[model samples]
Target chain A: MKVSRVASVFAAALAAGLIFLPLWWVFASSLRPGNSFVENLTPLSWRAFLPVGGSFANYEVLLDGDFARALLNSFLVAGVTVVLGLAVAVLAAYALAVLNFPGRGYVFVFVILVSMVPFDAIAIPLSGLFSTWRLSDSYAGLILPALANGFAIFVLRQFFLGVPQELLDAAEVDGLGRFGTLLRIVLPLSKPALIGAGLMLFLSQWQAYLWPLLIGTSPGKQLAPIALANLSNLYSVDLGQILAGSFVLSAVPMVLLLFFQRQYTESLSTSGMRG
Target chain B: MPTMSPRRWRDARLAVLLLAPAVLGMVAMRVVPAVSAFAESFNHLSLRTGVKEFVGFENYAYLLGSGEFHAVLGTTLLFNLVLNPVIVVLSTALALLLAQRLPAVGLWRSLIFVPAAVPGSVTALIWSTAMQPDGLLNALFAAIGLPKQPFLTSSGQALGSIGLMLAWGAIGYWMLFVVAGLKDIPQAVYEAALIDGAGWWRRLTAITLPLLRRPMAFVLVAGTVGSFLAFAPVQILTKGGPDGSTNLLMYDVYANAYQVGDLGVAQAEVVLLMILMAVVVAIQFRVLREERS
Candidate 1:
């Protein structure tokens, strides 16, 4: 039994190492001074995975460039998407889960089918349409399409369904309107689902590459992922700066996700049904 | 049903008001573009001349006849064929391993999950650097007295490397669902199996796995769709190749529409890709349903 315990710990450590060590290396290399990311790796020393003589030089250079603008743009886009998306999704989910209406079942089915439609496959034609409306190179173009995520709606509806019927009835008996019951009752109780769905919407827009690539082409509207990708593609590749930029881009969302780890994981568990 | 009274009318009106924004947005944004894409796929719109002509089945015929388009489909299938299974197995294994009561297991689980939280493009950039000839992976290989690999630079190994990056970014996220499923299993089932002298492998195959079918199916389907939509890493690392070897279908659609100025071909490819996805999803449902029965 003790031997088996040792083996399990060893296996867990190895798995964690495989996933976490590379990220640690990225962080360490980003801190290294003056393009030494390669030289440090040659002897496979601890220096390759540690910030021994670390400095903020790469970050200083990166922040001095246009990467800051890209980061701000990403936040702006993701922020607006989350706020507006939550409003739209919550209202629809409330109606679907609580209301007695004609064709409610059909509407729910429609939402399911639409949620299953992969956006990447349809992005080409969607971009063409957006171009015709002259929405290219704009934030509206970036935020509008993502506002009506069917999967977000689906998740919210599932959570709302789990909200007990008698609580809603009591709210109604106390003279709460439909919107009031939703805002005061359903919304308050569904915090985890809201945060989870919001995180989902936020991450979808935050890491969005193809949609932003096709729509927001101008320099002023550049996003972090696009900027990070372009940083590495330059004729003179700066490894330190690229690592620093990637570290920043990756670290921000990771912090947000970890902070809301419970909500995010639970949301994924619910959303897994849509798959 | 009875005719609408005032209260019923009010309720219906409220429902419509509540659902309007989301329903309208979904229809106008998602449903309209997708439905029109099918129609547009049958027409030719020349970007250079601004001339539009109805070209019934010509785009599909051309794409079907072309070797390059065939290669794109082949590469996409090949990538998904390897990616989905590998991710499912590895994630399940990780989940099973973590299901044990190891010390500081929660911390290790979060550490393993950190990569999934990183954005795909950022992970690709990190992996692109790490896969450089003299980078960390090769340095580790050399420590083990193995040869250095040309990961994203060589066409032969580029797709495999991208798959590795994706698996690294995704497995932890998927594993959590398996962990959740694992938690739902009754302790008595395992105890009963132990009393019957079932070994670990037997318990897993007979007890844990059959119980985990639902979550496992979810992982398989979600992993398939995620791998099918994989575009960022390919764009960041290879740009479809050292020799067009990594030119998967999604990238091909992007290139045809944006770079080559071929909207007709791009729309046709989109239609085909959707049909393929629908067919695969249907097959997965059928197989899973059969197994359940």
Candidate 2:
């Protein structure tokens, strides 16, 4: 028993160390002042140990500049996408899960089929349409395309199906119309699933790099990822600022994850396993 | 069972109201783009003259003829072939490790998953920084008495480095799914195996593997689709590399359409890629269904 305990402790420690090391390095490097890429490489130095001397100059520079605009743009894009996506997903999920209609299976299958198409494959054709619609380089261009994510629809439908049938009957018997039942009963019961779907949509949109990079070319219009990429080219490749910007960009999602740790883990795991 | 008149109209209206925005959005964003891409593929388009002329199957024929296209196709296939199995195996192993009665299990799980939450661009930036000549990785290697290697600069090492980074970042997320699958397997099954004098390896093989079939199918298909469609890492880290060695088909399509103004050729590639993905997914579905039966 003692031997097993020792082995388990050792394994846990090793795993913990591996995971935390990269994060520690990112934090430490980001905190370092100045563009001393070569100087900072040494493992142990007075520079590393210097505490209060480090400044938030890099972050200040980022926030006071186009970085701020990009961050706001990302929030706008991701936020709108989530709200709009959930509205559509919730209603569609309700229809598929509860309302009997012809060609229901076909709709579900169509959603699944679209999920299989990789974004890169269709980016060109999509961009062409965006150009024609004059939605290119616009926020609407980003949010509109992503609003139709099939994964959200499918997952929400599955969760809706799991809602107990008797509750629907009870609502109906209570003189509630079909819409009323869905709005009050089905929607409330599936809050966890809806939140899960919403969170997934937000994260996916937030992390979107390719499509945004392709469509949104104007400086102020670019999202966070595009902004970060642009930062490397704006001035000299200021590794310190780049690292700082990246750290800040990464911190948003991390903070959000901490708040919804349980939902985040459960939703991601369930989605993967189910799909 | 009451008069279906009001209910049916309401239902139809609700369905139309709910699905209209998404359907129209998808039609404009997804379906339109897809159709245009197919159409573009059959034409010869260039920016100089702003003229597009139909040349049916010529783009496909051109892609077939080019050595670079063949190389890109080969690289894409190799990436999927190697990376999919590695991700599945590694993620399963990690999930299995975590599912055991390990101490600080929550911390381990959180640590692994934190990277998943990190944006892909940030992850790519972190890895790119680490893979530099005087970067953290090389620094550690030198400390451990190993020769310093140009991990990302070397043509041979660049693709593999990107692949490893992607796998490292993604494995944690995939493992979580497998962990969920593992949890759904009742503890009694493992206990029964233990009572029968089965060793750890046998318990894993006989119990955990079989019970995990459904989740495994999901992971396999998803992983395959994801690998074929991978873009961010290649774009950020290697940009298809020193000699187009790391260029995957997705990047190629992007380049064709966006960079080269060859929309038709790009569209053709997209259609081919979609067909390929559909076939692979269908095969996985077949295999999983057959296995269950």
Candidate 3:
């Protein structure tokens, strides 16, 4: 028993260290000066994962460069996508789950199939079509493609199914129209699902690389990933700036995951394993 | 057929109103692009001239006959063949460990789970820097008195290194699913196994593995798809490498379309990739179903 307990503790620590170490290196490297970033890592010691002579100058340089605009674009685009995606998805999910409409089964099946079609596979032709319509290099180019998120609808519908049928019927008897019942009753009950669905939409847009790479090619239209990617392509690669940009790009999703830990886990547990 | 009542008419109208935006958006965006990709693969399109010429089987012939496409197909298959199983096994092990009554298990779980949230581009950036010759990974190797590795630089090891990077990002996320599956298993089964004097290994193989089949199947299929679609890491880290060693099919399609301006070929590659995915998913379902019965 004693031996097993010790072994389990050691395993936990090792697993945790594997993740924490790389992240700490990125965070520490982001703060350190460019030249010393490489120096600290060699002869690996605590100094490598710790801040030594760290400053905000790398961040200052990054923000002053095009990275700030890229960050803004990602935030703006992700924000719009979440609000619009959630509104669109929630309404559709409500209908699919609660209403009696002709061809409901077919519509439900269509949503599932849509969810299965990998976005990355279709991006090439989509980009060509977007550019032809003069939608490339605009916010519409970035946000429009992601607005119709079938995964969000699928998740929201699953949650809505769990709502008591009697409760919805009672609401109907109380003279609540379809929209009214959805807004007043089902919406309030489905907060966690809403947050989860919204998070899914937001993260997909925020981390989008290939679509943004294709459509948002102009300098003003560049998203965070593209901006960070461009840093290393320079003739003289700036390690500190790259690290700094990476830390910022990575931090948002991690923070969101932490903040909504319960809802996120619940969301994954319900929908993710279904595949 | 029954006559439509007033409430039935109201419900139908409401349903249409509620579903219209999402349905239209999906049809315009998801369904159209995919159908057009299949359609466009059969034609030669010039963006500048807005002229599309019908060229049946030519693009497919050009792509399939090319040595580069074959190598890309091989690399993609080899990478996923190695990557998916390694991830499933390692993550299952991690899930089993974390499921134990270890100290501060929540903290450890969160630490591991946090990386799944890191963006793919960010993962590429971090790993690209760390895998440098004088970078942090090498520094750790030096600390232990081991020889340094040319991780991303060597053609021989570059694909495996990319696999390792992807695995590192993927395992923790999949571990959550397995852990959830583990939770669904009744403790009574383990207790009964213990009463029968079954060893840990026996219990794992007999009880846990069999019961956890669904989640494992899910992890396998989803993880395989993810490996197939992996793009940002290759784009940022190698750009298909020193001699196209790291070029997977998705990036190959991107290179052909964007860098080389050959949409016809790219669409043909997309069609091939989607067909491959469909076949793989279908096989997985059949195999998993057969095992269950």
Candidate 4:
């Protein structure tokens, strides 16, 4: 028993260290001396993971460009996606889970199939469709497809299914319409589920790279991932700036995680194990 | 809970009204695009003129005959074959560890789970810098007197390196599923196993693994699809390069459509990917069913 207890502590610490070391390195390298590329990042030295003569030089340079715009774009896009996605998804989920109607089974299967069709598979035609209408670079093009979220509907449906029939019936008896019960009863009762669904959609949009890579190619249209990726291609982008940008990019989700820690983690596990 | 039993006509109208927006959006975005993409696979499209000429299976045949498609498909398969197992094992191990009454369980779980929140592109860039010739990893190699490795530049190492980077980002997220699975198992089963004089290994192999099949299956299938569709890591780190060593199928399809302007070829490649994903998911379902029975 004693041996097993000691083994568990050592193993847990090692796992935690491995997961965090890269994150620490990125923050450290960003603060390293010199505004240009980091030099002498030898692993044998503590300076590799912990910089010496640390400064704000990288952020000072990076903030002067489009990085802030990109961050705000990600925040705005993801925020809108969540609000719109949740509104659409919650209604659909309430209908699917609570309402009895013809062809409901078919709709359920159809929704699942839609989720299976990988977004990347439709990249060619979807972008082509937008290009034909001259909406290829617009925010609608980015936010629209993202809002058509089936997984959010599915997660919300699962939660809605667990709501008591009595409460919904009681609301209906008290002169609540369908939407009224949804708002006054179901939505309020499913707060954790709503938060989960919202976080899932928000995180995906915030982390998006491929769609922005394709559609949002112009300078003003660049999102965070696209802009961060461009740092690598630029002729004279400082390495520390790249690290600083990555940290900033990473820090948003971390902050969100802190705010919605339980909801975020629960939703992730729910998404994977959903039947 | 019972289905809502409002006035039948009113319920029907309300249901349609509620579902319309999502249904319409999905139709325009996913369903319509997928149908058109499928149609494009059967027709020859000129990128410049935007003209379509029907040529059933010619595009698919062309893609099947090309050595590049074969190589890209094989690379994708190899990545999944290696990556899925790595994710399964690591995630299961971490899940099992986290399920136990270990020290700092909440802190450890928080640390592991945080990386999945980082954008895949950002994770790719982070690893790309660390794996560069004079970066942290190679520095470690030098510190131990080992010769330096050309991580992203070497064709042999490029694909595996990309996989490792993705796995680093993926394993923790996948762990949550298996941890959820482990949490579902009844402690009574373990107690019964202990009463039967079972050792730790026996108890685990017999009770835990047997009961945790569903979540493990979930991890397996989801992780396979994820690895199959991976794009950002390959794009950022290698750009499907170092002699096309890391050119995954999705990247190949993307290059065909966007770079070469071969929309037909990209659509046909997408069809192939769809079939592969379907078959993999089917096999997983069958395996899970067998275990359940």
Candidate 5:
């Protein structure tokens, strides 16, 4: 029994290490000074484990070039998408959860149907239509199509449903309007849900590849992923720079994941039907 | 006016008022685009002419009869088939182990899950760095006295490499759901099984596995849709690769829309993918729902 317990512990630790090794490799490589390809490879060495002669030269190389604009574009795109997605989701969620009205079922079903249409399906026509309207290569084109997410609305509504009726009633008795009750009473309580939804939406947009690739074809306007890819192609010699930019691109979501992992997992647990 | 008339009317008005922005956003962005995409599938999209002209079923027919389309469809299915079972089984096992009373489980689980927090685009970048011809993977091979393998450069190995990266990121995600599912199971059931002289394997098969069907089904269905829509990894790593060996359906769709500048065929393929997703989602939901009711 003791041996088996030790074996299970060893196995678990091994699995966790194997899973996290690639990320560690990226982090370690990104921190190492440039032009150390041979030294970066050797296994079972401190050079492979820790940064030797570490510096921010790789990050400077990335940010001083095309990556600077692309990074800014990523922030703009993700920020707008989150703010817009949450704005619409909160109102729609409140309506669905707090109000009594006809055709709400139809509206909810429409949200599901919206998500059922695949990204590729929508990207084809949307790119054309936006180009026709002279909206291509702009933030509007990049962010508009993604602002309406059914999963966000669904999660927030589910969370809103859990707010006690007594609180809402008390707010109403205190002469709070429907909007006031929602803002003062309900919204504050749904912080975890809101944060989870925002983080997911923001992270997805920050990493958005296809939309920016297809629409923002102009130079210096691509998002981080597209830009990083283009940078690697343009400067394929610098592996360190590539790894550094990827690490930087992942910074925001990593922080959010570390801080809000519980809420993030909570959303996934309840929102199974989402894409 | 009576209190009922005023209050009911106000609530109804408020509902409509509140729902308007979200509904409008959905219609303009999601609803209208989808409906127009279906309409556009039968038309030719040409930037040179600046006007899309109706071309009947030509787009669908061309795609249906094309050899490239068939190859992409086959690759898509191959990816799903290879990825889904591995993901489900491994993640389930991980979840089962994590659910056990182990030391430092929280830190271990977090480390396993941190990979998921890395965006798909960055994840692709990281994997590409690792899989390059003279990359770390080959270095490890040479150290172990084995010949270097062409990971992303070889046609046959490209798709498998991408799948490996995806599975690396996905196992922890599916594990989260599985852990949640396991939490809902009663401890007494497991205790009773143990008291009846049942071993770990028997308790798992009888009590744990049966109870896990719903969350497992949830993971499978969502995972299938996600794997089908996987685009970033293929784009960043191989770009449909050394000899088009890694050209999955999503890449083909992007190539049609952006590379070839043919939205008609892209929309046509998108329609096909959506139908596939709908069927997969519907069947999974129905199976789980039936089991419950």
Candidate 6:
């Protein structure tokens, strides 16, 4: 029994190392000075692990370029989308979950069916509409279409369904109006679901490449992912600069994930399970 | 009873207040575009003429008749059929292995998940770099006394390489879901199996597999849907190159819309792709429901 326990411990350690060591190497290499990637390719020297020749020149160069503007654009798009998506999703979800209305099941089914529509298929028609409305290459163009996310509505509705109906009824009996109850009671109670869904939406928007790339063709309006992708010069290939930009572009979502890791994971799992 | 009239008025106002934003947004964004797309699919539109002519089923007929469209559909179907099952099995296995009471489990989880945080474009760039002739992967192969493989350069290998990179990036995220599912299983089941002299494999097959049907179903559907719609990696890495081996339906739609500026053809392809996705999702749900019954 003790031997088996020891074996399990060893196995766990091995698994953890398999995943972590490579990541550590990448992070360390990203922080290392020029030519270190080439230098550390072999011999496995101890000097490679140290910060003796490390510098933030890569980051400095990246931040000085279009990276800052792209970062801001990412924030603006994701931030606005989250606020708008949550407001709309919460309202729709609350209505469908709690209210006894005509065509409620049909609405639920429609939302789920729409959720399966791949964004790739829809992007062309969406772009055409944007062109007609003269909203192309604008922030409103990006945020407006994404605000009608079916996944958010579906997840939020499921959560609202699980909220005890007795609490809602009690609120109604206490002279609380529906909107007031939703604002004060239901919204407060559904914090976990809201945050989870919000995180997922924000992450999706932040890492959004295709739609943003398609719509935001202009330099100032492009998001981080798109900018990082187009950061190459006309002639020279700056590996260090590219790596630095990639790391910076990746940092936003990573930080968000770490902060809301629990909520994000739970929400994703719940969404999958429900689907 | 005296206040019923006022209460009814207030309820009407409240309902409108709650439903207005979402309904308006849905109409403007989803409903409007969807209707316009359906309308546009039946019409001829082009940048050259800037004219719209009604052509019922003409766009669809053209798309169906195109050899490229047929190839794209076949590629998408083949990619999904192969990629989805491979990812499901691998992700499930990884999840089961990691879900055991393991030391540094959090570290392992973070490592596996960090790649997911990387932008899709960046992932494509990294893989493209790694697939180069003198790249890290080739170096490792040479060190291990193996011949170098032209992973992305070869027509036959390009699609498979893109598929592998996608699976690598996605497996961790899916594993996280399966891990969540595995956690929900009670420990007592395993404990009971231990008392019955059941080995690990037996316990897994009898208890774990049966209990994980819902999550498995979830993975299957999600994987199929996601793979069917894959586009970015192909765009960044291969660009559907090496004689169009990597041209899936989504990329084909992209080329039709952007490259060729054929909105009608693009819309036609979009409609077809949606139908395919709907069919897959419907079949999956039916299978899951039937199994439950």
TM-score-better candidate, 1 vs 5: 1
Better of 2 and 3 by DockQ: 3
- Top of the candidates by lDDT: 3
Locate the minimum summed-lDDT window of 10 residues in model 3 chain B. Answer: B1-10
Cα-lDDT of candidate 6: 0.77
> Among these predicted structures, which one has the highest DockQ?
3
Q: TM-scores of the models, in the given order?
A: 0.97, 0.94, 0.97, 0.96, 0.94, 0.90
| Colliding pairs, model 6 | none
- Fraction of true contacts retained by every candidate, in order, equals 0.81, 0.56, 0.80, 0.74, 0.63, 0.45
Candidate 4: where are CA atoms >4 Å away? A33-37, B1-6, B48-50
Q: What TM-score does candidate 1 reach?
A: 0.97
* Clash statistics: count for each candidate: 0, 3, 0, 0, 0, 0
Question: If you assessed candidate 2 against the hidden native complex, which CAPRI class would it receive?
Answer: medium
Better of 1 and 3 by DockQ: 3
lDDT of 5 by residue, A207-255 (tens): 6777888788887578888888887776555889989888887667778
How far is B152's C-alpha from truth in model 3 (Å)? 1.4
Better of 3 and 4 by DockQ: 3
lDDT of 1 by residue, B1-293 (tens): 88978877887899899899999988978998898899999999988799999999999999999999999999999999899989989999999999888899988899989998888888898898889888989999999999889988898999999999999999998999999999889999999999999999999999999999888888888889888888998777788997988998888888888789888888999999898888887888899999989
Candidates sorted on DockQ, descending: 3, 1, 4, 5, 2, 6
User: Which is the winner by TM-score between candidate 1 and candidate 2?
Assistant: 1
What CAPRI-style quality would you assign to candidate 4? Answer: medium
Model 5 chain A is weakest, by summed lDDT over 10 consecutive residues, at A37-46
| Worst ten in a row by lDDT for model 4 chain B | B1-10
Over the stretch A114-195, how does candidate 3's per-residue lDDT look in tens digits? 8788898889889988988899999998999798998899889999999998989999899987878898999999999999
Write candidate 4's Cα lDDT for A144-193 as tens digits: 88888888888899889999999988998999978898888998899999
lDDT of 5 by residue, B71-159 (tens): 89888888898898789999999898777767788877988887877778778888888877667777778778888788888898888
lDDT, residue A81, candidate 2: 92
Per-prediction interface RMSD?
A: 1.2, 2.1, 1.1, 1.5, 2.0, 2.8
Candidate 6: stretches off by over 4 Å: A1-26, A32-36, A42-52, A162-176, A232-235, B1-9, B286-293
lDDT of candidates 1 onward, in order: 0.89, 0.79, 0.90, 0.84, 0.81, 0.77
